[model samples]
Target: MTAPLQGKIAYVTGGSRGIGRASAIAFAEAGADVAICHLDDEAEARTLVQAVTARGRRGFQMAADMGEVAQINAFTAAAEAALGPCDILLNNAGMNIRNPFGEITEAEFDRMVAVHLKGMFFMAQAVYPGMVARGGGRIINIASQLALKGSPGIVTYCAVKAGIIGFTRALAHEAGPRGVLVNAIAPGPVETDLTRARGPEWKARISASLPLGRIGQPEEISATAVLLAGPGGSFYTGACLSPNGGDVMH
Candidate 1:
């Protein structure tokens, strides 16, 4: 049987760990060659590349911080050189610093906006022309459930994530005409380094409040991403799929 993504090329940001790592592996397993970028953590990136290669698919890794436009362009160039034009682009690189609204500094807020909102916008811009030329492609941005329902101590995070959704929608309108589907994935509390950084108490409290009674796994999130990037997502664009354990039901 042919894989849904056979012969495709995928590019994933923040691919060193967590949802990004899992999604890259999943794409490879589905028969797509993958190129992933990380801010740092060469070891984790190497492991991801190995895992994808082990799946009998080509894998490439680059160290690039998404917060910088030049770095994003460089990473995309490297990916194209190594793997070819991207069929699926996953803008998942992000960071967070939690502090009370009054305590959060200007720099901290700027950092969050740069990484989440600015990065997502330009990354999409970088790949869009190629996608248009190819006649079709997929762009998936990783948002958060907090974007839908505000959270204490992370106002900047919430704002930027919300911006991601807006960006996805607007970009989808422009790109969809050119055969590029743009979407966002808003996940709830997941057992990733980012979420675990909130500490055990936060995790426990969140889990108790969630309908699933537990934080989600990276694999679960990755499955949703794979579906978005594969043939199954042919008709999906400008949609925000929230796999948030029922945290925010609309």
Candidate 2:
């Protein structure tokens, strides 16, 4: 049986761990070559590369800070050179600082925006032209459930995620006519390193509050990305798919 994404190339940011890592593996399992970027974890990134290659798919990895535009451009160029033009772009690189509204520092706010909103926007811009030239492609932005329903301590995080949704919608409108599909995934609380950093107590509270009574797994979210990038997702554009354990239902 032929895989859905055979012969395709995918670029994923923050692919060393968590959701990004799962998405990269999912793409590779679907028969796509992958190129990924991480902030500083060379060892973890190498492991991901190995995993992709183990699936009989080509893989490339680089150390990149998504907050920097020049670094993003450089990563894109290098990935394209190594794996071919990216057919699926996953803007999943991000970080968060949980602080109350009054306690939030300027630097923290800027960093969150830069990494999530700005990085996602320009990364899409960098790949969009090539996607257009290729006649079609998929761009998936990782948003959050907090973007739909505001959170108390992570104001900046919610703001930036909301911005991602807006960007996804507008980009989809502009790109859809040209055969490119742009969408966003708003995931709920997941058992990621970032969430785990919030401590077991916080995780317990969140899990109890969720409709599913537990935090989601990275592979669960990755499955959604696979759907969006594969042939099954041809008709979806400008859509926000939420796999939030029914945390915030619309």
Candidate 3:
């Protein structure tokens, strides 16, 4: 098979499981070395690392909470040391605390902001220089349909995701001349730990309402990430791809 990402280094945050894990494996399958970050899921990260290696690519994992600036910086450095300069960055790390807007505490709201919005910005900043030095690279941010349509009890989550889209567009403009492609993926109801946390019954009800009548799979989302990371995405930048089973039609 032709290696689209051969000789490249790809780093994915929160890759121990869910969309992050799927994207990391997809990048590896395309022939890129992978560096994955998991806050406290080293064991699962190890399994993912082994899987990436098994695909005939190099894989490394680091433990770091993306919500913390210090940890993110350290994680990036560790990944660089292990995987060389990053050629593709998948900013898949994010968290959402569901609660009525009136019940959202300052600290809880802050955590959501720190992890989803703040982390993506700072993480991009940390990796942009390397990508520019290399002449070109891809930065794929995982957003949500809620960010577009908004959702109850997830106000802060939606806010952060909306911020991600804005950030992607702005950063795309800034990074374009430098050869860095910045884009965001707004996935709909998907079957993952994140959705499970939302409640299984609620997950089903949401999926049933979708045109596709089914929740998305991690692998399905991973395919999109592959396109954004490979030659197929050469012309795509500053765009948000909605893989939400036709839920949020334009």
Candidate 4:
């Protein structure tokens, strides 16, 4: 039972619940010290920290609104102070506004962009220098299946996610020569709080549409993140792994 990320350090945003929480636990369990940033979910974040510590990995928790650049900077500072230089950055903090294109407002569109694209940009920038100094690091951005194939109603979300994909590719090229690897994952619908709110009927339909005939679990997504962060995926860069259960076959 060798740990792939033994003694590594990872920072995950929106780590209080859903995919971020699962990825944090996976990283810690794989022998990496974990730092998590959450906006308003202190209790859950604390519990996750405890869980990481239980796995014999150091855990750091920070409260920051990732949508704000100032807050992102402060959070990155806190994370660095607590966890030391971040070697693995999981840009998992994201927001979605699902509504008809006609009903979407300017502010709504901006908010969606801010949380996903802007936040991801700043977080990646914050970690780049440290990663470069260490001679290498890994960055994994979380995108969505909708980014590849647009979905109705949430046009803004589709655009932002698409931007993430482009961003991941461009950043991967920029970071690769410096020994860093950047990749993205576009997960299909999962059985999480966000999907649960989409109603039981929609959930059933989505599951039926998938080749696997089932919705994905957070743990499954976390497993992929773990592999990408470890040496096993050192040669993988700018690769957008789609865990969509055959929804978007290329």
Candidate 5:
């Protein structure tokens, strides 16, 4: 009956919906107070806050772009102010522009770097010092299976995700000994606004190609996060846990 994350505080980026939202609620259900940041989903963010409160957990939400350092810092300060110092950070805010290699624009490339690389890098920096000072914490970055296995038409996305894998592993070395654990989850095609935009044909085709004969759900991916952020994940650091329906086995 004891909650694994009881008395812990979790800060999640892009948590208004999908895997981030699911994990925020899951953390609360496991007894952690959650604070989330969204780009422009006040309605969804409000709904998520209410859901967390419904479960008798403190919830806080802020609207900010993860790509902007000023916004990331402000959001972090606000979240900690609302729920106390963060014990877990989910750098899950992300976006992708699925343009062909030849058609990828400078603007598009810049945005992807800003959101995925810079966003995650600074967000982790923001909370890591606090976590280490407190003697232990969790940092879970959302990566993609495509990072390991090459994919066409989303070259930039794949490149940046691969960068995340590198970042997670490198950070674990510096933070692990300091009592902060860093890891990543490289998920397969999942049901999200981004994936659904690919249409049913693409979905069905991709599903048939997977070893599991199906794509993944947000909760399924979030479950990996729950394990990483909970007591069970204490021994794991610098590890990449893939729940990608056997898309890329390692």
Candidate 6:
């Protein structure tokens, strides 16, 4: 049928797996060329690129750690060079260190902030100038349901995600006037490598707790990203869209 983002370009970080991978493909299917970067997983990244190209959209991939400013800059430059200036950006790259608050180390905390908050800041900075010059663009940041309602063991993660929401809202205030829309997505209990690491018992408990009585899939979350990137999200700036399976009803 008709493509909503036919002439657009999307940049997705941590696009080799989970939500990022699914979002990249969904964006391509919606008719945007996609550029993605991964920290390691070259094979998975390559496969994701193949999926994008198979959809008849241009695809670009590279290896870069979002936590490092140099790498983030390099990736943005390379991605824009290969796919042209980004029209949509999904800052989805991140990692978690789940433990009791008392057991959390300084190094672990630093890593979390570096990758989740700092990386998101610069990555958005890298594209903001162009989007402002071009008159508009969309930015979708990934937060977590925990950011709304905290989890016991993932204190740091919850805090960082909460920071993302604040960042999204504050950035929107500045960007909206200039035509760049910024927003955040807070998902609950999705099946990703991170969630899988939480173990089957944890999964069963989380699944049962959600009002939907099931865990979410990556594709389910990606649909939201597509909506935020396409014309449907034209007025969704600075908002936190939660596809949380009734996990955090507000």
lDDT against the true structure, each candidate: 0.93, 0.95, 0.91, 0.92, 0.94, 0.95
Per-residue lDDT of model 1, residues 109-222, tens digit only: 888999998998898889988999989999999999889999898888899999999999998998888999999999988999887887999899989999989999999999
Clashes, model 5: 0
Which residue pairs does candidate 3 place in steric collision? none
What is residue 115's positional error in candidate 1, in angstroms? 0.7
Candidate 1 positional error at 124, Å: 0.9
- Residue 245 displacement (Å), model 5: 0.9
Per-residue lDDT tens digits for candidate 5, residues 117-172, read 99999999999888888899999999999999989899999999999999999999
lDDT of 6 by residue, 128-151 (tens): 999999999999999998899998
Question: How close to the true structure is residue 206 of candidate 6, measured as C-alpha lDDT?
Answer: 86
Give the per-residue Cα lDDT of candidate 2 at 54.
Answer: 99
- lDDT of prediction 4: 0.92
Residues 114-191, model 4: lDDT tens digits:
999999999999889989988999999999989999999999999999999999999999999999999998998888
The Cα RMSD of model 1 versus the native structure comes to 0.9
TM-score of each: 0.98, 0.98, 0.98, 0.98, 0.98, 0.99
Candidate 4 TM-score to native: 0.98
Which pairs of residues have clashing backbones in candidate 6? none
Cα miss at 183, model 1 (Å)?
A: 0.5
RMSD of each: 0.9, 0.8, 1.0, 0.8, 0.7, 0.7
lDDT, candidate 2, 27-137, per-residue tens: 999999999999999999999999999999999999989999999999999998998998999999998888999999999999999999889998999999999998999
Worst 10 residues of 4 by lDDT: 92-101
lDDT of 2 at 184: 96
Q: How close is candidate 1 to the true structure, as a TM-score?
A: 0.98
Identify the runs in model 5 with alpha carbons over 4 angstroms from their true place. Answer: none
Task: Give the higher-lDDT candidate: 2 or 4.
Answer: 2
